[model samples]
Target: MTIRPIVRYPDPRLVLPAQPVTVFDYALRALAADLLETIHAAPGIGITAPHIGVSLRVVVLDLDPVEGARTYVNPEIIWASPEMILHREGSVSMPGVNDEVSRHARVRISYQDVDGNLQTEESEGLRAVCHQHEIDQLNGVFWIKRLSRLKRERLIKRFEKMSRN
Candidate 1:
């Protein structure tokens, strides 16, 4: 397993929009593999290519062990339910800090697999939350940005303190 280093929070790369994967080849497969390894090492339920400074529109989610991990290339939300849910969200980039964020309770996403095959998925609950979260990351919107300014500032302070200790 090749575990790539995760880019820490506040890195400009984390806020830069990721480039879409246009080539579906061995190298793309390798990057997906590396992403799976990296997310597992991060011990996170979901992760994006930007999390590892790849600047590619890729995401890996291991929300269900029985289902195994899934890779999404150039994932984007195609539709969202009117219902909303509050879920605690965090990031591998900014570990040890999390806050509740409101998100669509259900979402339909259009994406490509590692092989560059187009696919779509409809998800709810935690899976839906993860879909939105990682897609936001790919769009250069970190999870913390979903929080209110006050909450974001507080969370950053907490993270900063944790880093120092």
Candidate 2:
């Protein structure tokens, strides 16, 4: 039950791509648990290993009341629908900063569970948006990068002000 510190935006570590998790042993399990603890503490719906400066391609999403925490290790998007949609996306790393991001309406993803079992899921709407967002984080693509110049500038300005206060 360790709530690791969340790495904030503009941190170089957050920009560096996370390495894929190769081992499915105790350390990886511990990391998943830590991610869950940290995200729940952040009161956020999603979080990744990179958000905690661990630099691993691991993500934890709370599906609570259904299956609790769902951990994805080394996730990859296999396919995306031709259709698109917009959803508000934010990061646990970049707190208080969010914007509506356009993404494929549906996506097929392949990933490993916390115990290292391979799994695949096809999702749409908000769920698809979240999976894509977290996948971008794993690939070192900050959510701001998806925004237009004007929106990104404004978002940064707002984030700075929040940091000050």
Candidate 3:
């Protein structure tokens, strides 16, 4: 598995909707493995295929803090609780900046495993927020989009200033 470079914000690809994976082939499996490796290397909790420019509906999450890795293909949030929770979210793509975003406190997600088996799981707390955040990435949405308009504009300015340097 190799470490893939994460595409940062302002990259048009980040806003482009990802394509769904129709063929579960060896290459896809390898990509998933590489994604897991990259996430582990980043020491991050979650990653999406689009982050690396693949533009596939895939995400790797490791919230276990002890277990290995959890891979999700074509993940979708089937249900979410009305209760919302605010989490300070950061992204590997958007480095050095954390923003508070309100997301569902609980969610039930359905996705396919690396082996093509469908899996559904309920997550809460940080795991829930992380899953939703990563899933949003697959849909060409970023956590900053969940913020207020003024906040998003400020963040864009900040990112642009940083990129200029």
Residue clash pairs of candidate 3: none
Instruction: Between candidates 1 and 3, name the one with more favorable lDDT.
Output: 1
Better candidate number, 2 or 3, judged by TM-score = 2
Q: Candidate 3: lDDT of 55?
A: 85
- lDDT winner among the candidates? 1
Against the hidden reference, what TM-scores do the models get? 0.98, 0.96, 0.94
Residue 104 deviation, candidate 2, in Å?
0.9
lDDT of 2: 0.90
* Candidate 1 per-residue lDDT over residues 1-165, each given as its tens digit: 489999998899999999999999998888888888988888888988898889899898998879998999999999999999999999999999899999999999999988878999999999999999999999999989988899999999999999999
In candidate 1, which residue pairs get closer than 3 Å at backbone N, Cα or C atoms, i.e. clash? none
The local lDDT score (0 to 100) that residue 95 gets in candidate 3 is 77
The 0-to-1 C-alpha lDDT of every candidate, in the order given, reads 0.92, 0.90, 0.88
Runs in model 2 lying further than 4 Å from the true structure: none
Local accuracy of candidate 3 as per-residue lDDT tens digits, 1-165? 899998888788887778988889999899999898888887688998998989899898888867867889999999999999999998888876778999999999999987778999999999899899998888888778999999888887887787788
Candidate 3, which ten residues in sequence have the lowest lDDT sum? 61-70
Q: Pick the candidate with the highest TM-score.
A: 1
RMSD list, candidates in order: 0.7, 1.0, 1.3
